[model samples]
Target: MCSHYEAVNKPERLKQAFQVAMPEGAKADVWPGYTGLFIRRPKEPPQEEGVAPWREAMVGSFGLIPHWAKDTTVCKRTYNARSETVATKPSYRDAWRLGRRCIIPAEAFYEPDWRSGRAVPTRIARSDGQPMGIAGIWTGWRAPDGTIIRSMSMLTVNADEHPLMRNFHRQEDEKRMVVILEETDYDSWLDERNAEPRTLLKQFDPARLTASV
Candidate 1:
């Protein structure tokens, strides 16, 4: 599960990268519950029928709390969605079917390696230094005060055989990594034409990534 990440880029840079205006205040490093940038298809009003659907970069809580969830507390339990079961999981199935897909850009992510008999934090990023756009799904949640808050969950795929990825995570746990996409694939990711996003879910090339304790 990708529990933490850094997205220090300001609104301008994020705008340049995605051609959309990003809500200000993204943090250098965001933990669970921290607000971060998420790119999603815009919600066009019924009156603007002819206008094209554009992408928007918005601030969203890191952990996703389904609309039907009892409270924000449930977000703590759904920060990551397993790719294999995302289609059917109660907490994620609605958004998955409704095409509430999003792209979560980050400088790097952290994980734990239990090779030494204790969990050791490891930093993983692209060797080239370019930020990665991880696949995710977003949902709209309503607060007790009748305010709507958007939240997201990163998607992960099995990577047990990945050399660099297999080294992380406990030996007893199933090896997994967030589905990182190529910059060229970002547009396709935001498009609704691709019904099965899983077809693009893949483990990034280990050769292009750097992992250190």
Candidate 2:
């Protein structure tokens, strides 16, 4: 999965790239060397009609937390959701069916592969050098003291036999990659009216995308 990414551009640049206004007080987070649009629930969801507005503290990092978890540590292990099983997995089933759906914006992401027994890191982004929208799911957890924590996870699907991705995903294992969406699919993917998995999955197309280092 896309464990590392980059959004080196400033928040204003991201806004200009995506053609969306920056939310008030929204700032860039570049810690861990992975920069991208960082959002909290109830505040960042889309405000347009048919678009699901982001929550202020409802969407945190790209990791998911099941509502039943006793603590937040589980989030560390859920940075991605496998599309093949997300619709049925216990931790994600309910959320995928009822709760939160979001988009994570990124200029590019990093993936590592073993080259001659040494790890080689490569950066992947659109060949056209445009921004990408990664599909995600969000969850809200309430602490004992009533502090609520919101988190999210990127969704991954089998990578196509693209030249670049093929080098990293060599096994039949459910190799994960971010769910990249096209501009025309954004509204439908965010529509509350189209919550069904089949409907949402139909909006993704790997053919239109190209990846490179």
Candidate 3:
């Protein structure tokens, strides 16, 4: 699972790489070179007639609470969702089915490995240097005092035979990588009309994605 990412370029660079509209009033958080789109659930009331389009929001470094949780600490354990069982896991099932569908824009992510007991960090990005869309889920949780806390988590799947990730992943433990979406599948994945897990899962194609460490 990706724990760090870098988007050192301007938002315009991300726009060009993803070919998507640039987010308005965007700000940069450079500690980890964080840029690109990070999404959260809207605080507005749910529409009675139709589903509202996913809204964007900036989240803190380590906070991701589910809507129904009594406390926010659960989020710490939920930074990443395992693809093999996310659809059935108690923490992610509801969000995966109906509540949360989001895209995390990223340029490159960092992976660390223990090489001879030393932590060696590696940067992973596309060879072409295109922006990538990581699949995620979000929720809107209400606090006791009526404050609504929005949170999100990234989804991960068995890693492909990508040479870059092999060094970080274990041979026996199913290798895991973030779920990346293609241009054509973005709409369908975000469309509330098609929230079925099967339909969403089919949109991911490992062949179009390339990584370098």
* Cα-based TM-score, every candidate: 0.91, 0.75, 0.72
**Candidate with more favorable, higher TM-score: 2 or 3:** 2
Model 1 lDDT per residue over 1-213, tens place = 788887736655665566666567666787778888888887662233232247777788888889998788777778899989998999999989888889998888999988999999999999998778889999999988999989999999999999989987778888999999988888788887787678888899999999887
| Evaluation by lDDT, superior candidate among 2 and 3 | 2
Flag regions of model 1 displaced more than 4 Å: 44-53
Compare the candidates by TM-score and give the number of the best one: 1
Which predicted model would earn the best lDDT? 1
The alpha-carbon deviation from the true structure for residue 159 of candidate 1, after best TM-score superposition, in angstroms, is 0.9
Off-target runs (Cα >4 Å) in candidate 2 are 23-59, 169-174, 195-213
Question: What is the full ranking by lDDT, best candidate first?
Answer: 1, 2, 3
From the highest TM-score down, the ranking of the candidates is 1, 2, 3
Instruction: Report lDDT per candidate.
Output: 0.83, 0.60, 0.59
What is the number of backbone collisions in each predicted candidate, taken in the order shown? 0, 17, 0
| TM-score of candidate 2 versus the correct structure, residues matched by position | 0.75
Cα RMSD (Å) per model?
Answer: 3.4, 4.5, 5.6
